[model samples]
Target chain A: MNAPATERFVVPIGPQHPALKEPGHFEFTVEGETVVDATVRLGYAHRGIEKGAEGRNWTQTLYLIERICGICSHIHSTAYAVGVEQLAEVEVPARAQAIREIICELERVHSHLLWLGVAAHDAGFDTLFMYTWRDRETVMDILETMSGNRVHYSANVLGGVKFDLTDESAVAILKGVEFLEERTHHYRKVVSEDAFFLQRTRGVGTMTHAEALALGVVGPTARASGVARDVRLDAPYVAYADFPARIQLLTAGDLEARFLARLDELLDSFRLIRVLVAGLPAGELTAKRMPRKLKPGEVISRVEAPRGELFYYIRSTGGEQPDRVKVRTPTLCNMGSVITQTIGHNLADVPMILVGIDPCFSCNDRAVTVRRAGDDNGRAWAWADLRRYGIDYYRRIRN
Target chain B: MDTITTQSPPRWRTMLDRLRNWSLANSPWLVHYNSGSCNGCDIEILATLTPRYDLERLGVKLQGSPRHADVLVCTGPVTRQSADRLRRIYDQMPEPKFVVAVGACSISGGAFRGCYNILGGVDEVIPVDVYVPGCAPRPEAIIHGVAVLLKKLQPDRAEEIDRLLVEAGAVVGEEEGIDEPNAELLGAR
Candidate 1:
């Protein structure tokens, strides 16, 4: 549908579009070259993960949760393990905590580099995309050598970590980190100094501090906008308490700032890895004992995922299986800002803006659809009405 | 109409068919779609294109549209919502196209086996020509899978490639069990 004179046209990208690495649907209403309005529809990658978690036992459920997002699989399982361990009242060894922190930081290096390549590809900077990804292989090799798997390392067990670092693997990791550090210096220079790349990023999709705070953005996206919110610094779960992460902040709040925020975070990650490795705690890899059944309790675990804040809520009814499990990934927090910022921009810049948030469809596709009773034509439901309807519906099911 | 039905095909028609097959076998373009993956396999598939794996050295390129692609590379199990869209993409591809189902989830719903919304595997929604196994397979494994598909595209060299794979310990058939019981259809072959 289009207006007669104004001629507003909607361009739908998704389900199988090429610019996106995952499946998502976005409708951008444009007037000539400028985008007027934008709306997003998710759930293309929804596999009923939350509902599936309810059916499996605690340990089996951990494996399923690790599949939630392959890019951030380590952080997903870390959040879950932290929460589950809290509910079980089991104390993991200090060495295990240190190893977990090291892997988390390594995963961040890989994830951020992966995002840099994908964002560069979206901006038509294929050379940067190829070079970044090529260098990303170094971190991937280190992960594979440590955990035996590249993408889903399964590094974290419920009580502790599965693999331990020896002097040899430690040396390998240091070597890889050193090489990556050099590359990071070059990439940071390119992101800030290269005039053509800056044109695509600088001052584009600028989200101010107030707008970032209002939208509830998280991670590097918010950090770029000058929001000082990081779960690792705030909560300090696992070994983060000992080896703290330095927060990278910028106030420009533009695409370039987001790139710089992640790059600067990489430098911090390299330093953190060095400190964690040098001061490797000497202890057992796992706890002495972890009960098969967890105690009846609810716990919330928050961790700084490579993207932003990753939250896991666990409620166990003193059984082998959890009663309810909920996850809120960083992409969900940053998605709103994308829609708000896309307006008043050119259609060609929409992909770059979307990639700016490094959106993950599979990680944030937990949703449900509801319609008003006896309504023939579908209409949007207000929040209050929807909440009332949910209460009544669940009550009816209980009865 | 009677003359067209009764006459044999022209020589140019046969030559053109051979030419099309040669090009399709030489440079097999791929279009990747995520039905409901966890993003593990999708990233690995992208990694194959990078310099480390260098899948393009095999003359394989990832296309942005299905119409221009010769192979449909799918990841993850088929979710109910994405089933229709997956089918539409497959329908849009040109004829003689093949589907490569990457990741254990897409091959048999892997970890998400009994999820309510999952339809179980890429083969449930579309025919899969090759299945690459792993929670997320390594990029080298993905390249091997592509080499296998390329061998299948050229039947004349299938035996030579099968011998090479066997010598390299990547046995082509009967070892890595898949649901598709056709013994000859297994492995990159």
Candidate 2:
């Protein structure tokens, strides 16, 4: 059975929804079960973070900006610190740079693990979801041992990191690494072998290389679609210059391919962390002192977050606070392609399509309300109307 | 190797079976919801399942969907817009659910307490079962919080609901505002 040729069915997936974990509205225009058009709405979680950054001093703002997104907190702080330090011409110690790299890589590990679990759940593989998260905890524990808190490590200051990795902490981290490596192997097996996962994800939500580039998709989403774009490799930031990044590229643009790409990236992060921790530099963890005032200038910083390329454009005004802090998260770019990919897919596959980008609506917050052409037919068509129409059409055709 | 049957099970039957099993074990699948916060509690919550703390041995798994998860691990102070989304997520989870407020912010807004954007704590909008107190609680503490939640999930623990209501006294009514209660006032808020 097909949708009525003259009428289009519209489905509003959120402002609140079971399939979506974050707050954002998505409206889909469907022909039968296929999504003919999709529109996303965000800003459901806007907190005036940029405005808040205006009044706070550079030091206080460091802690403030890190709270932008819990998963990407460290990178936000890193980007902010990098901007302020650049403006002040402050050189952080080599040890602190190395420490920043370690923490960033650790954050990537945890974020990817969390994403894996979420992706698995979207495909209804609850066991895989659990296993990936269980493994993710090791990375979080390592961060906690280094810094007092697990989520907001508070390790990054304007000039350098606040906490140094003691011998005990270092040993504890190495031990955790050993455990993670073993767990990752098991995850690799399960992710590959599970038939239901393969059925749900394979060839679903395919984003081709051309489409990904045109849409400005970044990070693993872009890489999964056969684009070799990684900010860490292209523009080395912090200690990224010291360690070579082994970027993982996948040719398949399917959901499974995206899942595999994230898994591969997680393994590479593990290797990078080992190198960083082993080559621990001996020096001050923070710079001697940063200038109280910044020079008036504009600087743009890009870092490869767990999701993809995270861009920060900061304009300083020779004051304690920045004049403007504009952030363009990876999800913002990746979200554009959801409509293109979800079309021609089954209704059951909608969540999989949404999750193919490892969407973090928390970071990319904006929801668009969609209005279609010709909805003024003086009739409101609910989801039930579409279902009923489909059922009746099927019965008539069979008869 | 034996090939498994590919026939789709009836939806109602499958749901009933899974529900029965889930009720018996009370296995909570957790989906970590970040509104806006420092990464402290988010990291510590992740640590709970690592080898040192290893929360998985207790049959708890972190889930991705509000639909599948029995517990929602929410970290952050509720921002104006995120409050609506958080409420939607809370509504999406299947019946007999629990929320774990795992950080000082999730429990009582922590360092960002008086900040303009923050709504203080998660419980300001939704019901919370366990509160792990720390600027960011350690992984071990997070694990402990989860264990406490698992206990509350038991079918026979109806009395715990009253305990939570009692603990969240003023806020439960209109006496206290939607701003989260402080950690010191958590047990007697």
Q: What C-alpha RMSD separates each model from the true structure?
A: 6.4, 12.0
Q: What does candidate 1's lDDT look like per residue over B81-106, in tens digits? A: 79999999999998778889999999
lDDT (10s digit) by residue, model 1, range A113-172: 999999999999999999999999999999999999999999989899999998888998
Question: lDDT per model, in order?
Answer: 0.89, 0.74
Clashes of each: 0, 15
On a 0 to 1 TM-score scale, where does candidate 1 land against the true structure? 0.89
Regions of candidate 2 where Cα sits further than 4 Å from its true position: A1-8, A366-399, B1-75, B82-103, B106-133, B137-186
Report the Cα lDDT for residue A252, model 2: 87
CA lDDT for candidate 2:
0.74
Interface RMSD score of each model? 0.5, 4.1
